[model samples]
Target: MRRREGGARTGRGVGVLRVVVVGLMVTLVGRLWFLQVVSGDRYVRAAAGVSVRTVALAPLRGQILDAAGRPLVANRTVPVVSVDGVALAHQADGGRAVLGRLAAALRQPYGRLAGKIRMCGPGVARPCWPGSPYEPIPVADAVPVQVALQITERQADFPGVTTELRPIRVYPYGRAAGHTLGYLQAGVGRDGLEAVYDRDLAGRPGRRVVAVDNAGNVTRVVGQDPATAGNSLVTSLDARIQVIAERALATALARTGGTSGAAVVLESATGRVAALAGYPGYDPSVWTGGVTAGQYAGLQLLSRAVQGQWAPGSTWKVASVAAAANAGYRLDARYGCPSGYTVGDRLFRNFGSADLGTMTMRGALVKSCDTVFYRIADELWRRGSDVPRRTATGFGFGARTGIDLPGEAVGAVPAASARPGDAANFAIGQGGVLVTPLQLARAYAALANGGTLYAPRVGERVVRPDGTTVRSIVPPVTGRLPASAATLAFIRGALSDVPRSGTASAAFKGFPFGRIAVAGKTGTAESAGHRDTSWFASFAPDPAYTVVVVLSEGGRGAQGAAPAARQIWEGIDGLRETR
Candidate 1:
């Protein structure tokens, strides 16, 4: 009985001990649950602050092409050497040394790279900035394939350096199509067609937030979407003709000693701008280098050829003829050229200050008779401003041509003037008259296309990647000629005679455009300081192509501008002969 009692006591003691241990374990488990589940976010953020890193993925840029599907602008992928400031923050000594070496290789100040490193930190979600990866911090953009290969070969040496492909704009034609095609910088469009179509020309930038390891090495990518590139823009410019016009126009500018010059060649039937050139052109590729404030200032300072305007000289006479012809005035209407004509208070003299006697309406254009045109202007405006204004409107003059370009200004051909003297100027395209090279082209297109003023097109078409048409331009008829068809032909015939005997005789040199019945008109206007602005508006085969040349701050229209017109006409003739 004594042994049985002792064994029972020992069993009770052992049971109590087991209960105590179980209770202790329950308390420890509850504390652990509270720390892990309830306070998880705080601890996780703390851990991520040191370990997580992110990188950016830039989208591929769109392509730019000429009318013939030729690549006027191309893309290149360059390797960029970038440093993660957050990655480099923990490794300042090593980063500083690496940056110094990179700066030396790129011949830049080390502080530039250092400043870039400071912008990126462990706090940043993504450390890859698109520009300079090292200082301003740059890795390289659209890196050369050889450099990419070199990076691949020496991948071990470049720890934080990343080599990626990004699209950059390259002008294959050099400065040939500079003003028309414009350029892309960091895939952003600037000026001309590029600026006009920026939304379609530039793609969206993408982002990827990569989760890095404890060592600042990217472990896995997370919570990021790939970037999409911008769509391409195709221009209406013909590459071959663009080159020809640029070369010829540049040569003309050099020879003329004029302030500056511009040319516009259009398909008369379709109103397609074949070539638009502004001389002393700036390279569109220079934009890719990022236009320096100095360069931008230089471009801004350039104030001739394009935005500059002068008297259209005698070219105003064509508007006079078109006005009279369209107004049911006879082409054979008789007018006598005197020593000079007195209108308002000023006396208008012939070009050489000499007088030609009696001239028929067509004969007036042949001799560019000032008195005859002055008399006609008196007749048109003498009754009222309606005749001159109506005639100018029909030819699409004194207005913006509504071209698909930026910075176009509507020239001044005021319907109502401050004085009657302004009326005299209106008849001659003088006082308060302003028009652009683009405007002149559109007006000439009207003459070429039987008075149909189609909307001018530069961006011919935009075709989407999915084989859908993004946008398409259509033809438009602004207004009809004021004259009957016969009258229009009569005016056209007078214009035709211009190349043979009038102010434009020097333009064709010896070209046989007469066989095709090319019609044209020449204009010369002089301002207060004896400044000259010369013009030639020509169209061949009725509705084919039309070209307009305007030279500002030059000599007489027939003497200075006519030679350049001849060269262009000769080019057309050569092309036509071969065809």
Candidate 2:
């Protein structure tokens, strides 16, 4: 009976083992069927999605044209050599062998070619690419057509290399209007007009759908969305005038041995900038490919016309006269014009210390009598009036002119004070009073245009690729002069006589007043340790053009800055004659 029971237990155990094995076999078959039939399409779609990529093709940058439709900053097409980083990765030797072959063909070093395609990360330096690893990296831009064709035709020898047409900035006038025209770096504007209107100049980028293999190598282009070109910017700049202004500035620097300077030509009535020039100018093209921080800093790319802050010297007399007149001082009444005027412990002497006795405010302006204006400032200070500061602010001084450019300097104006020499210095545009060349031009423009102060306009309009108008740029009216029409008229008459018989007369000795009657002021402000700052601010009453020239560390406004203005005025006269 015991033997029979043991045999039954063994049989039962064997049966249970067989049942468990069958159950596992059924479960495996079910899982296999589910994978093959239920979710097969989903997995396949995911795998295909992993192999596709969409590339962004940058649009053709718009042209920056002058008022007469001449291009100051335009684009030129050139062949660009690029490498597919992903395809290079799939190469048998990790793209090294491919890059070596490419470097040999392109006349570049193997290391440089390899560096151009390397993904940028911590510890990686440029020449390294900056975007996604899948994007084609530009190895060389502006390559010759023959070299580009050689690489493209010999695809088997140089795998993953490509030649494409790319648009780049070209300055037709060279460095003529460098400051105003600005420049682009890697499709982004750096300063001036370029920075202000970058969005309008850089149009929408297009999409390019491409396919890649499992190894992340691009196989073929599938589809593309055509790019839309940017709208062209039309500026008020006259190309010829811009060239003339730059040439005149160069002449001034050479003649006066000035370290640096700025020049501006503005439409007095409309507030349109005709020509804006700056010294220590550079070719905008240098920023095309790339520039290191050291290289850029060494360029000294500041725009003195809009960014320079310097004392107006006697040029501040215009504002001072207005300030005094508006503060109830008589424009027709006579004031003392001594060789020097004392305030507290300081004595402010006239230029060359020559006194012309006593004269009206108008005569003081023509003579640029510092003592008379100093008295006006002293009186205003004694009365506790803010007329000087208010007049300066009203005339667009001690502040930005709100010109449509980046990096404009908001010049400083000291608060109202009775600190002895402070009022006298402030009245003569000395002490802490400061103004930019552009600001001075705008102020003179307002004086010439019946006291309508406008925010200087450089960009005139924006036009689409199809020649439709995007919008017209209208310079906003910033403010009106604080003085009355009679006070302004008297000031205008005095300024009109300045170039004819006053302080600037020597500089305008032979200037053709018959063709265009010119009016302006001459200023030579002391610049601390450096030489005096030379300034000449003038305008044509009839045609209404305001021209201002300033020379840093250049002595005598009548000697340095006025001559530059005269040269520019001569050129302008010629322009007017031709018209």
State every prediction's TM-score relative to the real structure: 0.81, 0.89
Error of 1 at 527 (Å): 4.2
Local distance difference test values of all predictions, in order: 0.67, 0.86
Off by over 4 Å in 1: 1-43, 50-56, 80-98, 108-159, 184-189, 212-220, 300-308, 325-328, 379-382, 418-420, 465-468, 475-484, 514-516, 527-531, 576-579
Could you tell me which residue pairs clash in candidate 2?
Answer: none
lDDT of 1: 0.67
- The TM-score, computed over Cα atoms with residue i paired to residue i, of candidate 1 is 0.81
Cα RMSDs, all models: 7.7, 5.7
lDDT of 2 by residue, 111-205 (tens): 76776677877988765667766677878778888889999898998888889988878889998778887765642337878888999999999
lDDT of model 2 at position 42 = 56
